[model samples]
Target: MGVCPECRAATYQMRQGKLREEDCLRCGWLAIVGADGTCRCCRAAVRLGEDPAWLRAVLERRLLPAGRPLQLALRMDGLRLKTLPLRQTRPLTTVKLPSWARGRPAELQDDPCVCVTEVPGQLGLFAPCPRSFTREHGTRIRGRTPVEWPIVLAELKAIAAERGVGETWLVHTGDGARLALASRPPTERLVSPEALVDLPQMRPTVQLVLQRAGLLARPRPRLVPGWWSKGRGSCRDCLAWTNGNDQRCRDCQMWGHTHADGPCHRCGRGLPLRDGHCRRCLLLLAETEYDLDHIALEGGDQLWFGGPYAPHLKTTTNRAGEQTGLYGRRRLQTKRRIAVQTSRATAHTVSEHLAIPGQLLLFHALRDWSRLDGRPLPALTPNAEALLADFTSHIRARGWTLPGNQASLSALKFLVAHLGADAPFHETDVRLLAHHPNFAAPRVINYLRAIGLLVPDEKSDALLATARRYADEAPAAFQDGVHRWIDVMCNAGTRPSLPLAPSTVHGYVRRARTCLNIWHTVGIDDLRAITADHITTVLDTLTGETRKTTATAVRSLFRALKREKLIFRDPTRGITLTVAIPLPKALPDERLVGALDLLPFARDKLSLTLAAVHALGVHDQRGLLLDDLDRARGRLTVRRAGRLDRTIYLDELTHQLIKKWLAERHRRWPSSTNPHLLVTARTSADDNHPKVHPRAISKPLSRIGLQPGRLRMDRILDEATHTEDPVHLIRLFGLSPITAMRYVRAAHPDRYRPLPIAP
Candidate 1:
């Protein structure tokens, strides 16, 4: 329960209006029941004079509001106002049942209920009176009832129309019970939601709303015309009017035109442009299009595809310019003309003949057969055709007169064979031989042979013999002839051969004059002129020294003659000749002893007498007496010292005697400190003392005197003459017969008269 706003103190119940005992609790106000069954304080109305609004207000405040009364006039004219019961009317029998009772039961109950019924009149109003009184009074009473709300019913019909429903049913409040009424009945004249919503009275449909939000269905595709078909046009290939091209259509016309542009579409090409028509479609229509046949023919189709080589079936014309019936026959004639012209051109203009078979094979291997038409021909083997073009160019450039055909080809073949794959014609050799004087057959042979080309033996033998005959000539002249010979050999192609050795040729020339000279001097001709014996005799006569000249002069003359080619000597002859001549002998001078006596020596008797006065002057002080001197003399005998004989003579004796004298003198004077002589005897711990030996005196004496046997020879020779006793000199000097004679001659050249020779 809650208090109403009109009567704040009044506690109201929900869904209940007329009350018999309760007063307005708010402001101590009184509850006035108006005829219209509304709350006066709250100005809230209710159904059947029941104040549900007031009750709702009072109950919502603690829960709502209390009832209020309507104005007098409003209450009087309430028939125009609409109303509904606040609560459903319970059955009379159910009113007496307990609160837990569900449906209507068979048990009967009799109870007097105080029910408030609404009254209706001209000034319709709701009055809360007992049902018993209303029945008892029966004074023409009008009970409260529900009025039909035409506005609400019309709104229901509008909702049905918006929802696309056919008919709509609604419940309305009546005085006694609820009644059902059709807001609108289903009928054949019903409109769809789309149509109804589109009407001004209805809202938009779902599809139209979606369309406004940019979610509509995709539009259907449309057809458009092509560029050529959009206007009048003709097919470029077949020249057919595209607009009226039978049943072909524009696309088919395009395809047909494309097909018509092929090689077969021309008039003579044999392929029909139309199904049964010979002329193009454009021509039949008398329309302006390119004259395709005339254009193709004028553009050199005959050159490119007609005649024998054309891929299509032949078309022909006769010599008089009329079309021929047998096309193959005309084509054959044309082919024959072409072949004749080609052959003439090739033969006259081209120096080199391209071997078609070889070229085709090469093209097949390289897989570039189409290139054969324009590519230069490959030079297959050693052949003349390969060289002609180059050779012609060479001869023309040099302003040389070329040889005849046979000679030129022969030379070219020789060159080709000689040069091989790396032929000089292919490179520098071309330039070398291009302007050569002998560019003909014979010269070519020479060139081939000069470079050691293989050739036949017959030609080689002839050339070889000729070359040998002239081999001894000067190099320049010889080489010219050899080159000519080589040329001949080359022309002969291995028929002739030649031997060429630079050294041998040079040697032969050098020997030529010498051989001629030898021949002339010996007065020999034929085989004898070249014989070794005669040559040797000539060398001896030419090289031997003559009595009229010195040996040196003779030797010089032989060398000069040999160098000048005046004579020839064979190194193979190792013979030599011995020549003898008288030479003046040198005689010794007898005054040599007097010259020896002038030298310094010791003055002892043995040194003066036995050693000779000359020997005395030559011997040093210690050399006068030294025993080792004798030992050295014996050791210096002929065998050990390379003398002529082993016998000891005056020179040997003098040296030994001096040695003995020096040794004895050195022993007597052990302390003598002289280097020239060893004398006296003293022991001391000093290194300056002289250790003179035999050689000390002998070496100095030999240097002072030019003795034949070192120093002793002069000593002996001098001593023997000083005594003037040959027997004494011989006995003391120990001279042999020959040696004695030599000494006698030296000491006394005039005195030593050789005994008359016993003849």
Candidate 2:
């Protein structure tokens, strides 16, 4: 039996785990069982040799109520406890003492030579010292003094418990030591601070003071390397004995060991090789390397290196391993794996053989498959049946604007459906399937051959080559002639005069393509053989802007061909089309007023004014900069398309709108260095200064049911109808003479009276 750590009884066994203490002998209390199978009657604080019990017992006898009052005593260097003569205040009709210090008013007695001070604002003796209690000469003395509040309270508690008193009082000694003594037992008692301190010294009458004054933190056990372990093992690299192997003991392992092999191929570590590399690199090498037979959908798949594919591997290990199956084989859909493999192989083959633009388009189609019809993409397998079905479904899912795009995709899908799953291209005669209108003619056959689908045959290859050129040369019979015609015009020095600007040539070619789509010409030779009657017949089908633009382009193409002597006769010789420009739609007074009223913010008002009153287009408005505004002159300089610059006078409302918006713009982007008047906040902090999206202006106007294009036209018509002068019309609306003439007819149809033709 031994002294219990709790209950102050000798009941616990010396080897408690070997012989459990069920109960304490004197108290008859059951011992509390611990996790380590030891039994304790009370906590360590109440034990015989602990600081708390020893300290409490020492203070109880000397300074507590032997019914004799205690005193505040001090030594020159510090403080000590001694007895004081009791003083009683004169009894009065009513109690003379203040309620707060009713029972303990005697402790407030002064000793001027001693310079006593109380820890104010605290009711209990052992309360924590606040900043107000730690001041000396109206300034904080926390780090300066040795005797702080915690130490003082701890001393007071020791004195109180030893004196058999429930309360203690403290005072600051003139020498800066705070002395405490038993005053009298009060109703409230402070918790003792002895339990909080964890230190080595524990004995009777021991004062558990902080190591540094005012520093209440318990000292933490210092940690040295291998403090808890037995002797550190020998170094792995040099096999030398060491206290701790962590730093390789510096001398034995660090400078002594060098790599037996060069650097590791995977991790680049210069260490002796386990299997031609470090153990870590070997493990990593196994995880990343792939096995086609047992491709894993999850991690930790073992990979085998060596044989045919070993040269492709960055590193290898001595432990040869092979993959048998996937981690989550049951959960992985078979079709998903096939689809992924097919798409990857197809993209790789297309990129290797096709032109850059075609490769990009095909890859985009693959990526945007799910978004094409706003539905989930169907699962596709690598087999021909599944591929063909998925390809058919994809075409029907969304409609494309260009026929050429649809045709190209159809051809690509056909090749992928057959050849993507490693089907032999030699056995699959793609040309034979061309007779079936469901698939496009063998355009994708060359792509399949390039990706190792075909078995080479010189005779068949030569025939396929001729067939491919014929297919490429003829797209649509009508389009074939237009392409040929454009090719002749594009070839430089073949023309009699210097070639027109590329943009002008592009416009002509565009119109020619449109014409071919409208008519039926088998080839370039067929178009060359067209009579004047045929040109007129085609032009008759078109009217207004289409007729004018198309007629001009066709006439230009034929004229160029005639000059080059490519055609014997010019079919467009007598074919002519009149340019007809219609009058712009005028906005109703109420509609205009309603749109202006609906302008929600300053920017909207500014954007609308540029579009409506100033007759600026959306493109021109977006290009407007701070420099374009001439505030002093009250005019704005605008750059229009076709390299045209126009200066327009700003009205008072327009000027104010611009000014207000500019002020708002400056406030939002105070540090912006972009030259454009409009800007947007960058989505990322690292992005460059942003130009406002075109939709920013359009979306606001659209909300108000005002179209920017229609507003510009309304402004043009307003000027045209009101002024009636062609010159004014040209200057204000930026119209050509021909366009102004059309406006003149609309404004004053009866201005030109025709004299009757007499017989």
Candidate 3:
């Protein structure tokens, strides 16, 4: 009890609505009451019927910031409103179920009725209700009939929704008529209740509850077009004219045929698809995968269908402006066509020796054949054809061997394959060639350009900029000094001058570039700044012949600089040559013979011949003609470099092997017009001779661990150790006296057993 301001005592009873006064029980003093239900003594009003916004505002103002929940609960008279702070009230969960519940079932006489609190409805808001009726306070409620479960559930749901509570579960208690109303939804529901009940119409309600419990899956709707059952007419939603009364546009329904992940790649049926293929297209996709697998397996061996060699077609025209085909261009094309056809036929043959992996690469190449035509090539000018003709004439005039002719033609073929026939050459083609793995070597590029096939592109950074860097970075005085030395060495007239070969000159230039780099590194780019110390650093860093070459190049550079008065002393003055006699590196006799015996005809014919000739003490092998071989005398007249020729007597083994090779060669190339003893497998020019490529001959020897130079040395050593007479050495192996002395000096002193004097 509290006291009012005027009265000393106050009543605790509250009254509202029309009643304005309350008498104090103790003193009988009347207290004034406001319509808002505020106590006159305490000046406090009941929280009932307060505006939701005002309540929220007051809560936000009074409550500490950390204590505020995302949703604030305002307990009004008839409604517990969940609201945002300082905002209006709105329900969070809106679960709207159809009103399909029927009347409640009657209680059974056989089963005892379970007493339960009556579930309240709309009146429960303002008035007190049974504990069972309030889902928030009670745990269980009982009903007599299971058939009435749907109706009871409907009522419970409505009550829960009105009170702003979450889900409630209806669990069977197994008692006569008792059911449990859980505060939260059950994870698993009991289906035995439905099994015992015989209510056909209420089965759906049971299903609904089971669905909420997640014990049963929701029903799937039938996938049918809405317009199928309706008559054909224009759609109201979209203004497009329709074949049927379809409301959706055709594009919308195109992929909506099924409820699966996506449309089937083949039949437009919605699906879970793979490789963009449906069941209908699966076979095609599988076949493609099989082919690719086989192709990849074959490609792993580094062989492809259009490989071994990429094909090219060449055509020749006569003076009458018509293709005369006299140059055998047509014949060559026919041969290539036959070869391709034969390869494809073999691929399809499916022989036991030729597996699927071997042929599948060819099949892949066939697939890509059509696209290869459009591949970009190096561009050339109209004068390129004339230049090529003139170049070929020049090569012939120089008396290059048949192999040299073939090599030049092969390089030209590579050029024509990328740049189409009639395409003019450009400097860009040189840069492009630099990127090629096989032809990109600096030396190779120099050869191609020297032969007039490639021209330098001044604008390109690759070759031109590199050339410029070498030129512009070197001081004019230094480059002039280097070039003057180069010219003196290249000149044949000067006394004490060793005329440099073209390759030697190139090597000197390359070496000078290295010395320039070292000079630049030491911050001395000028010729006058060059010291013996810088030259020594550059030479010391190099080893073997490279060091010797660099030292020589620098020595020449310093000598020229000194003569021009650019330096007071020679930078190369301290450099000295330490010449060491090279010991003969001859292969062991047994290993050499064993390697020769191991050589099979199918492996290589050129290597067999090369090894045999080496064993016969024939060092020179250039331009050896069929006439040069005297098979009757077991002898071969070999042409050495610089027109030095000699006839060497071949042993029985070498002679018989040479005869066998000649027979094999005839059998293999019956139509060959070449007169050279060893000729190229294919021809490029109209010349009658096409010698075997040096690379072709060298490949087998390299594989068999036999070096020609070493084999030649072994033959010379065998002869040198046999006799001390220089005449016998020179006559047997065709060596000069000075050359014989080197072999004699290398031989053991005991091996030089002189013949008994006049015995």
- Give per-residue CA lDDT, model 3, range 1-759, as digits (tens): 232442222222221112235332112334443332223322221133333443453445331111111222333567533211131222232322223221123332222322333443323333222222121111223333444446545654654466576543323212211233221122323333333233212245444444454334434365445435456654332223433445543533442342235565655655434445432233333223334334333323222112122222232567886634312355444654565566554453211221121123322211122233433333333444555565566555544454645644544544554443342344454444445433433322444555644445455334333433454556554666665555565562234566656556556666788778667666775777777677777777878888887887777667755765657888678767664557675566676666765657732544455544453322244366788889888778877666457777777766776778788876766655566676555532224254556665666666887665666777777776777777887776677887887788677655545447512
lDDT (0-100) at residue 59 of candidate 1?
40
lDDT per residue, candidate 1, 1-759, as tens digits? 222233322224221333322233222233432332223443334433345654464344332222234332243433444332222332122113232332223343222222222232233233212121211111111121223334334454455467566631222111111111110112212222222222211123322332333322344364334543455444333334433434423433443553343334334443234433233432322221223233334333222221132222233567997644322344344654565566655544332433332122222121222333333333335344444455565444433355533455444643453334232222223333334343444334333434443242232344345545554342432333233333333343223345334443333333433444455554653321244454455455554343222222223323333333434653323434455432212225553445445545432323333333232223233332232233543432222122332233335545555566566655544443344333323211112334444453345334545432333555666565676556665554445566665665667667766559522
Q: Could you give candidate 2's per-residue lDDT for residues 1-759 as a string of tens digits?
A: 332343222223222222334332212333433322223422222333333532353334221111111121222445322211111221122323243422223333433222233344546545333121111211112223322455655664566466666421222221122311111113313322332222112212223332223333344465444433455654443333433636344432333353255576655657555446643344344433433345543644333332232212122223455322212232133444665677766554221222222122322212222122322223333464464554445334322233644554554554453335434443234554444455554334533454555544345434334423432444354344444445555564354355455566566766666555444453433556667776677778877887788888888767766766766988888765555435556778777886777887888888898888888877777787778878999978877667568888999989898889888866765555567766554311112334567888788999978888888877877777777689888887677897787766666768854337511
Residue pairs of candidate 3 with colliding backbone atoms = 305-362, 380-423, 380-424, 380-425, 381-424, 381-425
Q: Candidate 2: misplaced stretches above 4 Å?
A: 1-190, 194-504, 514-526, 536-548, 576-580, 597-603, 639-645, 664-674, 678-700, 731-734, 750-759
Judged by whole-model lDDT over C-alpha atoms, candidate 2 comes out at 0.49
TM-score of each: 0.14, 0.38, 0.38
Report how far off residue 193 is in candidate 1 (Å): 99
Which portions of model 3 miss their true places by more than 4 Å? 1-477, 492-498, 559-570, 602-619, 670-675, 680-694, 750-759
Using lDDT as the measure, the top candidate is: 2
Candidate 2 is scored at a TM of: 0.38
Question: For each predicted model, how many residue pairs clash, with residues at least 3 apart or on different chains?
Answer: 60, 8, 6
Least well predicted 10-residue stretch by lDDT in candidate 1: 175-184
